[model samples]
Target: MTEQPRLTTREAAQRLGVKPETVYAYVSRGQLSSERAPGGRGSTFDAREVDALAGRGSRREPGTGGASGASGELSFRTGITLIDKDRYYFRGVDAVELATAYGFEDVAEWVWTGEPAHGSRFTAPQQFLDAARLAVDALPVHSSSMDRLRVAAVATAAADPLRFDLDPSAVLACGRMLIPTLVGALPTVGQHRSGEGRLARQLWQRLTSQLPDEASIRLLDTALALLIDHDLAASTLAARIAASARAHPYAVVSAGLGVLEGPLHGAASGLAHRTLAEVLERGGAAPVVADHLRSGRRVPGLGHRLYPGEDPRATALFALLGAIPQAADALAAARDVVDTTARHTALHANVDLALAVMSVAFGMPAEAGETVFAVARTAGWLAHALEEYAERPLRMRPSGHYTGPRPPRPLPA
Candidate 1:
């Protein structure tokens, strides 16, 4: 096959967050069928094949069990995952401190490659800059910066011969490099890469263009830190699955981006933002929210799969938004929602509500919420990809489909 193809078993395994044997299992389930390799001891698969197995894609229902093996509940797991019932961390370090104290470019490097602060001493290469610039310039007007990212990933992979290192430090560098180049291309704004500004700050500034001072930058910075990584979430699983196949960090991140694009994980901020906008626009938040509850509507941004009582990040952010006039209504709604939901289910607000609160406080346009999340979560994406590079098996397995009537097509059909 002359196609250079998309991915392989080991690679797909990384994204699936399963053992290589599991990938084979998936193949057996017909969730993922194997493609022929030249000499055939094992079958090769592509990113799309695994994507199809995700239960949202083509092969989805297969006569039963929608999206199995996810193990659903966010419980204790096999890896050393750091959780934040209230505060985010990297192993043990407080993420808020890192976001506040460190430069975003530095933070991006740390997350992508897991290098210590000292490692960013080297600058991004010129060849990378030139190619990244061209990629940015060539992007079509129809695509958002997020879509442009797909093109950028392809370009970056082809331009850099050294893009495949799985070492923590190596992938970290890729993350730092990738975010800046991509954000630099967004429309109605420009990414600041020089003279005292960092990439994270630049992204924040662009996304929150309607905000005041450096406060939005600081808030965005911490948000990114807190969100950078959290073990094997579905999207992170996608990145890891790509990496285990020996694909480079860029490819892993790209696969992860695909998962992030899915509504289940990354689109909450936008959804919450839209809801709050309506509540705020309709006069009083409390009454409107009360009406929603009376109508049996579930409020967005009020719950999490993990933290039941409270999301620490949400708490911190809510506190920050309390004094801002623009955010007052959303903040008030959050308070009532918390009070109402608190008495019923143990569920309290998560980062989504707080983000909506901040979006209003910072005076950012409603659409900015999604972009802000994508910016911050990019850190987490890089971290997950690095994990793929460093871990073993690094493969995703799925059962195969035996759909086409086994032996023959009877020639004339």
Candidate 2:
């Protein structure tokens, strides 16, 4: 039997006239189904599905949960997070309210376990922290935080004797330790302090070169909470694909980290940061946006396909940052970027804009936004992992159509 040829994600995205992330969004919304590409590094879509979605208008409303892809129908069910009417929800709770009212630990519990905000304490064994530090330090000095994070994940998994304990309670226990241990092992820019109050505070120490006040801390906390989950992104889907194979929690997260490194995914924040910084240096948003247009490049950070208008997460975080005096210039620049882009294109300020503003306000690196996104989205990844673990294994394999030149006429036998 001849194997059907599959389309790489980029090919599928091209056929659909959408970006790769939009392909993932279509998968999340049940407009498509993806299978693990060989070696489990990424995903491949059914060529027939792409052809079908291309034939039909795959550009349905973003939040609606039905479309016609392969197999003549598509629908996905998830209890984790929802993006509808330009707002985000966890289960049924308002994400903006959760961001304002609780820390990331509490938000993680809510997103992962669907329990009310119970304020559960996240604790890690001392030995795990020690091992994670060694693992992190083994990376090259130029490595990004996500690079170190991937290393730490594998090392932690190797150290855990019960990593394959697929029981719900056991998996949740592993998640609790994974988040804190990953955060604590990284080198800090500020003076090291022992025993932080919340996950956000500890993460703030790792990210910024200076001490932070309550307002900045709250802003960071809101950023983390807001990023906890977003339906099923590429990273989340990768995590779920690993989980469907019954891979351990750490392996699941490693899969997510690998996918998140894509520039179109989590690392997009870095590009957005660069854009905002250029806007600031050029003295206004108009010039930078003009340069982007003249270069025939899409303006980074100002648009998202998922949101009909401004991304709600960016809107909420920008509103919070407007309260901080230090954030005034960054906030104004972001607004100008948004307004300028809107005048020329259909783009609006997305979460990447908010992340750039946060990094600028707090004196962090360009990639700091990606780091924050990685940590916060870990919760969502674990949640999706659990959901996939409950389903049958290898559930996402996409069948393809053969499109080669008629088997090469027997290949010159």
Candidate 3:
């Protein structure tokens, strides 16, 4: 086969109408692949791939009011997190910094109220916790963690007479209670520590039987904080839509949970966990990656559309996981997967991969990452719901673009 001509990084960036850094981001995201130059100095990309990507970008006509062209975009003003240049910020503060410096409860409180509530805690009311647990326990033995959470949300809503109250204070109160209830409802693998002071400590008992060290607990706490919100994720959007329809806080959470079942979203970590476990068992990433590709499945936990470069969440968690001596093997397994996949398509590890590392390292089940995601993201769903509630009701309803047979002509048999 004749060798294909290649474009240098600068030329690729120019061809794609993006910066050199963005070209590198494209490589990291697996949107484009690059190879080391002959002398191993700089990277080069296939000319065809760069042109193809540019062609895709050019499809959207400029000045059409939205990135999708004439149909426009559904945009809402949000004072929450902002993602820019591979870094995300929560209310103007760096999310990674906030997560590292403060506990999940404190960070969630800050995201909710725009000010840090030092030493903040989320405690489930006995009534709500009991209701949620009863609902979760009633499920079949084979039910997944997300199934329990969805049912718990409904049960907690039924138990709360004040759930209909949409006042900001009332909603905030519900958020504080609801988060803990969700965590408390899960079946504990070990002896339940119901009275643990920190939410992280409380959740620790439910996730694994092994006693957690200080560093492990800190890792869990940071993971929760980092995941608290990520601007308009699919589940967050679902929650906002429900809130736009005046659904109660618990219903808003239910809406979010409803969307979390998709393989691409909250369940992604579970998939990644299984993959990592397989890699550990198989003893190498090559055959596993090959199997995944041969089956036509994009390796889960590899790339994220929002982050072109490295996922900041993964970077932070990997840093923390590095400090933990027990995580070394799982961490090495994760790196091997990333490195192996990179040879074919340059993709960076996303948060799902990091979550997988934690789950695999701590002897947690495959679904454990999903459980953690559901519990942590519940706070974010509520935060978005609160914002949506303040807007004009039903504002999210958009007119569907009618593409079928023109109105009267569609009345045929």
Model 3 lDDT tens row, 94-194: 99999999999999998998976899988898989999999899899999888998999999999999899999899999999998898889888876555
* Tens digits of per-residue lDDT for model 1, 361-407: 66666656666666666667666655555555533444455577778
lDDT of 2 by residue, 229-329 (tens): 99878888788889988999999999999999999999888898888888889899898988888999888887677888889999889888999999998
TM-score to true structure, per model = 0.70, 0.82, 0.82
Worst 10 residues of 2 by lDDT: 63-72
Clashes by residue pair, model 2: 302-348
Candidate lDDT scores, in order, read 0.63, 0.84, 0.86
Give candidate 1's root-mean-square deviation (CA, Å).
11.1
